[model samples]
Target: MSSVKERFLRYVQVETTSCEANECCPSTPGQKVLGEMLVKEMQAMGVSGARMDEHGYVYGFIPAKGKTDAPAIGLIAHMDTSDAVPGKTVPQVIEHYDGGVIRLKNGVEISGFSFLESLKGQDLIVTSGDSVLGADDKAGVAEIMTLCEKMLAPDAPDHGKICVAFTPDEEIGRGADLFDIPGFGAEFAYTVDGGALGELEYECFNAASCKVTVKGVNIHPGSAKNQMINASLVAMEFAGMLPPWERPEHTEGYEGFYHLMEMSGNEEAAELKYILRDHDIRKLDARKQMMNTACEVLNKKYGDGTVLVELRDSYRNMKEIVEQHPEILERAKAAFLANGVEPIVKAIRGGTDGAQLSFRGLPCPNLSTGGYNFHGRKELVPVQAMEKMTEVLVTLVSVK
Candidate 1:
């Protein structure tokens, strides 16, 4: 059976970046490739019913060594990597970290933070600065797989029925879109996709995808004067209208932001895509209204049909649902403490598959994979944390 680190390294080599441009179920074929690999590996570990569904979701079953009266726990992690930075790259393994400024290569360093102080003396896996290390979910995947391998051992500990799922297109926000929650059959689940070693999160931002379109009349450059209304300029102006202090970089700790995700077009037409987020539902609604208001003001400046704003809700805070089932969090915290890790219960600034899964009646929460700097070239994971997390999963599923 492969170790967590080995599985992580091998899996990261596969390019599984889920494309937002694609409308397909997976949005990328590499997700299917990784899904197949997960199935084969699980089957090799003597797990039953390990198979990838038609839409590229992988599911497997692990029967308890002895039957007990405990909820069937599901362990889930996404199979797709973010398209933010190139997530398809081999990681540079550091056997031991001295922990100062970890320079991957010339002019590239993972420094300027106090977080590295804790990683000293631990084994670290990092990217070469050209691409992301893919630890965001792959580390979670490895931990779950390693946990399965241990559960199948001759002297394996007792656990209730185990359900494992690997989803695709999580980065594109469709990971739970095609999810077959009923068939998976877990009373509750935990997504092992989070940063740091001990993060246990249930609350996530109320998310919405915003699209702003600007249309303009164009004329000859020489005849342009006031006749040619520049759409791109108007789009920029609309962006300027939003509070500049209310962006991702300027905010933290329950502070919401209007993140401009994408913007493009010429003077004749332009489109700006943003993701609006807030922890409070009222504030989330206000943020949406703010966008619509901006569009209204811009339309008055140009014309009635000049600017258009479209908003789509992605996910909501899982706190309300997860709070109803507090035992899951209690169990996770106990498991973390048992494994010599502190449980860092915090609210997620971003949404997870757990946020959606919880609202879908799974009462899901997120666990940390001991990874950091997700969705960027600076991504890395601690070796020992992954191992501990694997143990944590074991204890979480183990019937006392």
Candidate 2:
């Protein structure tokens, strides 16, 4: 069997970065490139139904080797990387890390004082400084591939029928938009797409996206101070009116946050984009209402039509769905412990494809990929942790 590291390295070179502005199902052609590769790989491994659909989803079935009574479980991962950066990754390996600082060729550094400090004694795979490592979900794809290959081996333990899917556009939050849950025929599913070694998450933020547009009267600078109304300054004021402590940089754990994702302005107009998140449905609704109130206050100050706020719900927390199928979580926890790793059950600060899938009638939970600092230049993954994660997947499918 090919090692997880080798599989991951091969997957990341495919350049499957998702495009948020695209209207297509997969959202980018690169996703199809990876999907085709996955279909070929799955077929080579003896998966009978390995095929890629027109929408770029690759699905296959691995029949049970010895058992016929166990429930069919689905293993899923996204093929696309985040559009936050480029993903034509050139990965480098650090053998037997001494644990100080790793300097990239492009002047970026992963310092020991950073989260990478804990990975001191392990082998690490990182980017070459100009691109993202694509470990966010590619590591997930590798884990699933490794597990499927192991299941086909003669020495492998018995397992129920397993369904596998490689989805696209997860980074842009449309991973499950076209998912065929009923056709996939799984009692439950797990997305191997979380961070760190033993992370297993079922709860994700109830999410929304807001856009605030400000219209201002642009006057000549020579006209005088009283005639000038700078729209950019008003946009900054709108941002400042929110509670400072509610921002992402200040919160952790169960604390929800309002994140300002983008801002652009001119003398005549300005637009500010924000993403709001909370695990509690009540708090999530309140946050949207708060944005409306803030817009009202600004409108009152700048005139009725000067400020407009548009808020749209993206995805809700998946806990409500997962709670009904508690056995899924229990089995995953047991699998982790069986592999000699402690299960770290926590709430996801951000949304995953599992969040949407759970709402779509699949009790999907997020599993760890053993990657850290994702979607940036300093992204890294521990070799040992990734191998352990692959083992956890195999164990989850094989052990009763």
Candidate 3:
């Protein structure tokens, strides 16, 4: 059987960075490439029906070991890496770390912080200094794949049918947008896409994307006077209207924040993009209303057409949906404990595909793949963690 770490290394070698610039499904062609690769791998592993959909989603089926009443379970992970940094480079596996400051190519160094102590005797998969390690969800993908391989063995333990799905464009928050829950044929699912070891998340932030546009009159500086409205200044003023203390850097746990993602403009026009998040639906609504109010007050000062804000709901907290079926959580906790890993339950400060899936009637929750410092060059995963998580996935799908 191929180790989960080896499978993860193979998966990350494919460049699957999702693009926000593209409005198309899957976001980038690289995502399709990875999905196709996964489908082939699954088919080679005996999932003859495995296939990649037109939208770049890959699905595979594992029939029950014997006819039984156990509910079919689904395991999900994203195929795409984050677009925040370059993600084409394959990872370098550092074997049996001494926990010192490990140096990489291009003069980049991986800081051996106190966290390194935990993995002192284990192998580590790290970046080569030029790109992200792609362990964010790829590790999750590998773990699920390894589980499939194990479960497919002739002498494997008896289990219920299992569904496996690999999605694209998760980095851009569209992972669950095109997901076919009914077709997946699972009573409930779990997304293997959290950080650190043993992290479990059922609650996630209620999310929204906001775009504020400012229309300003541009005139000659000498003749500008009261006739000219600086769009850049107006955009800054609009940002200023938000509470300074409430931002991603300042908030934690259940706190809500308004993140100013991007702003670009000339005096004639300007646009600001923001992502608002809160753990509570009521607070999320209030945050959106606050953004609208900010625009309203600014428009009142600068004229009716000067400021315009557009707010769109993205996803909601999954706690309510997840609560309805307590067995999912209980089973997951049992799996973790069975693998000798302690479960750490926490609310995700950001949203996941599981959050949207839960809302879509899947009652999905998030689980960790034992990766840390994701979406950047410093991303790394321990070999032991991947092995343990693979065991957890096997336990999760097996009939108890």
- Per TM-score, the best of the predicted structures is 1
Please provide TM-scores, in order, for all candidate models, with all chains considered together: 0.98, 0.96, 0.97
Best by lDDT: 1
| Runs in model 1 lying further than 4 Å from the true structure | none
lDDT of 3: 0.89
For model 3, the superposed segments whose C-alpha errors exceed 4 Å read: 112-114
lDDT (10s digit) by residue, model 3, range 1-400: 7888778888899899998889998899988988888888898889746988889988888998875788899999998988778988767889998888878776688885668888887999998889999988899999999999999999887888899999999888999999988888889999999988899999898899999999999999999988999998999999999999998899887889999988899989999999999888888899999998999899989999899999998888899999899999999999999989999999987878998899888989999999988888888999899999989998888888
Model 2, clash count? 0
Which lDDT values do the candidates have, in the order given? 0.91, 0.90, 0.89
RMSD of each: 1.0, 1.5, 1.3
**lDDT (tens digit, per residue) of candidate 2 on 199-259:** 9999999999999999988998898478777889889999998999999999999999899
Clashing pairs in 3: none
Residue 56 alpha-carbon offset, candidate 3, angstroms:
0.8
Query: Worst 10-residue stretch by lDDT in candidate 1?
Result: 105-114
In every candidate, how many clashes are there?
Answer: 0, 0, 0
For candidate 2, the TM-score is 0.96
